[model samples]
Each structure stands twice: as C-alpha cells, then as structure tokens.
Target: MLILTHTLYLNRPEGEIPIAIRIYRPEPKDGCWACTFEIDWPEGTKTMSGAGLDALQALVISLQMIGIQIYTSTYHHDGALRAYDNEEGYGFPIARNVRDLLVGADKIYL
Candidate 1:
C-alpha cells in the first residue's frame, strides 16, 4: 500500500463542532485510494471530542453513496496520534477499493 497525505485547515464551523481537517491520500495506483481526516484544536482547549471518528464515519457514509470499498484500522491505545485521556483518538486505515468497503453497516473505528 502506498500512502499519501493531503492536509486541510478550517477557518469555519461544520455542524455544531468547530473542527479542522487534514486529509491524507493513498497512492493512486493502488487498488484503492484511501484518505485520513484529522481534527485540529487550539491552545487551552479541553472539551473538543468525538469529532474525528464522527467525521470518519460520516466520510465513509458519503463514500458509500458513490460506491467505495474502504478499510479502517482498528483502535489501538498506542495508535492514536493526538492522544487524550480516553476522550479522543486517531485512526489510520486503508480502503481496499474506494467503493466496495463503504457499503457495510458496521462502524469502522480505528
């Protein structure tokens, strides 16, 4: 799997959450092209939570609408990038095919 990254900075709010996103892309030649979205928080922030997975799950739903089969990594205590005291986490997973994986009803929590 060849991994690539695309980062995004947000200056506005989406829904009731004030979140920023970073999108990472997998190598195009691979069977599937995958992406990761991360949330950015500012200094002194202490109550922002659940945005990452929620965003990821939402993305999966959106991808499924178009036909994308994707894979998400499992949740590892040590795998979280922006670690919190069980309040938040990070996941990096691959989508085997862009459209096929998104057709399931299971939640991909990584």
Candidate 2:
C-alpha cells in the first residue's frame, strides 16, 4: 500500500521539472520502513529507494538518493551553473521541503 507521497522541483538546464517521491508499505524490514522515490523527466524516469527505522528516515534516505540524481542531471545539463554540490546534500533538502505539506495517508512522519 502507499504510505505517503511528496513532490519536489529540480532545476535543470532545460527548465524545471517536478520529481515525485512516494513511499509504500510492506509491513517492515529489519524494523525499518521502505520507500521509493522517482524522478520523471522528458527523457524518462529513474527510481531510487531506501529503508529506515522510521518513516522520516525512510523519506530522507530516499530523498537523498533522488538528490544525487538531481545533482547529476543538473551537472549533465550545465555543470558550471549547478546549484549545490553532491557533497552538500544535493536535492534532499529540496525534496524534504515537501514535508511542510504533510500530505500523506499514513504515519509517514513527513
């Protein structure tokens, strides 16, 4: 079942794109929750996921992975004008900001 959903905007050279992040429920694994985040672009879509002890951590980890993609995609489009470095936490914060909305169906803790 779907636990929660969030959206983030990534700055690409072509323009801005909305990245949809989602979490699914499957009980739990090793006491951690599972989540999957997807980045959809005009070219295609890429998926990344993570498991965490709680909902927020799961969301954060998944977001971090998407952040890496955002960084790489931005770099691919225009390396010189990219916003933040991969080491600087990439688009994770950008994704996490969606938490302010807290629009999940379950205990997402987002």
Candidate 3:
C-alpha cells in the first residue's frame, strides 16, 4: 500500500481541493505490477486500476483523470524537478537550490 496526499487547484468553481490517494499492489503477475488506486476527494471517493511499470506510473494516471499532469524533465543539467513549469518566462527560478529541486514529483499536486 502506497499513500500520497495532494492539494490541487481545480478549474471548477469550488477552487482548491485536498485529496488523499492510496495505491494498492495486490501481486506482481508476469513481471508487471497490477495496481489499483483509491482517491478521496472533496466531492466523494473513486477507485481505479491499471497496469504500470511501477506504482508511481499508476498514480500518475489516476491523477490525470481529475485534470492533473505528472511528468519529468531532463533539459536542465541536474535534471530539474519533475513537473516544473517548462514554459518560457513563467517566473520560476532557473537555478533552483537542492531544497527546491528535491521537492519531488509529488509537489506538482500542489
């Protein structure tokens, strides 16, 4: 069982929403992880399942269903933080310190 918490700003009228996500891996079959997820959102609860290389990938897809995008970047020399805004001139610091870069891919949920 892998658990993650994320605060997301939705485009809907309700605005920011806090969600609790849980991923469960029953057993590996044929060298693949069979993952299922349970999302506890403000509105209600939802569950889903899919096949992924790992649990993280499965979580990414579950979040995408609610309009969240998760990904990584290799453009920077140190391979900038995952989900950092890649758009030109967005006001994010170009040279981020270890603390900021170490935030991890989960920070995108914020």
Candidate 4:
C-alpha cells in the first residue's frame, strides 16, 4: 500500500488550498515501472491513495507527458514523459531537481 504523510497547507493566490505531493520511486520490470512515492497532504483532509493500476498509470503518464520530470531518488532520472534533445552546445541536464519539472532546461531557449 502507498502512504501519504507530511502534509502542508499553503495560502496561495488561489486562496487557502491543499497541496499534496508524492515522490515516486519506480522499479523497471517487464518494461513497466513499479515503485512507491511518499505523499504529503493536509493533516485533516481526506484524500484517495492507491486506487487502481490503470488510473495510476494514466496519471503518471500524464504527468510525464507535460515535462514534469519524476525522479526515482532525487538523484537520478527514472524516466521522462517528454523527450529531451540537445541540438545545441548548451549543456543542459535533466537531473537538476525540479528544473525540468517547472522550467525546461536553460538551453531550451538558447
């Protein structure tokens, strides 16, 4: 089963909102990835966890397709939903922790 812990609520421009995130660590087997992530949510809020394989896979693939780089251990690239090609000399790597998730590599604009 997956566990969701260490939840924190933040006041954003969107008003008081609940944001929960989990770090997914995947293991490759039979060309499919498997792993668990640490989820964080509000202490008193109710959220769904560990639903179904189809849904989870869909969510993960969606996240990846949008360039949200999911890391295995915060140090290595488990895999990317988007393809990164370096056609220029600007050496931009995807391992820069959330960089690829939020902003495309610096070389993207170069």
Best by lDDT: 2
Evaluate all candidate structures by whole-model CA lDDT and list the values in order. 0.30, 0.53, 0.41, 0.35
Q: How far is candidate 2 from the true structure (C-alpha RMSD, Å)?
A: 9.8
Which digits, one per residue and each the tens of the lDDT, describe model 3 over residues 24-88? 65446567655666656445776766555775654454444322211222222233212224321
Cα deviation in Å at residue 11, candidate 3?
A: 9.3
- How do all models score by TM-score? 0.20, 0.47, 0.35, 0.24
* Candidate 4 C-alpha lDDT tens digits along 1-110: 43322222344456544434453434454455544443232344222222224545634543332222223223123222222343221122333454543434443641
Better of 1 and 3 by lDDT: 3
**Between 1 and 2, whose lDDT is larger?**
2
lDDT of 2 by residue, 53-108 (tens): 88777767776565546544653345332223342222343254443422222114
Which pairs clash inside model 1? 67-99, 68-98, 68-99, 68-100, 69-98, 69-99, 69-100, 69-101, 70-101, 71-95
Q: What ranking of all candidate models by lDDT puts the best one first? A: 2, 3, 4, 1
Query: What tens-digit string does per-residue lDDT give for candidate 1 at 1-110?
Result: 21233222223234222333344332222333333334343442222111122445544533332121113322121232222223332233334553233212232552
Deviation from native of the Cα of residue 47 in model 1, angstroms: 18
Model 4 regions lying over 4 Å from their true place: 13-15, 23-28, 31-33, 36-94, 97-110
> Top TM-score: which candidate number?
2
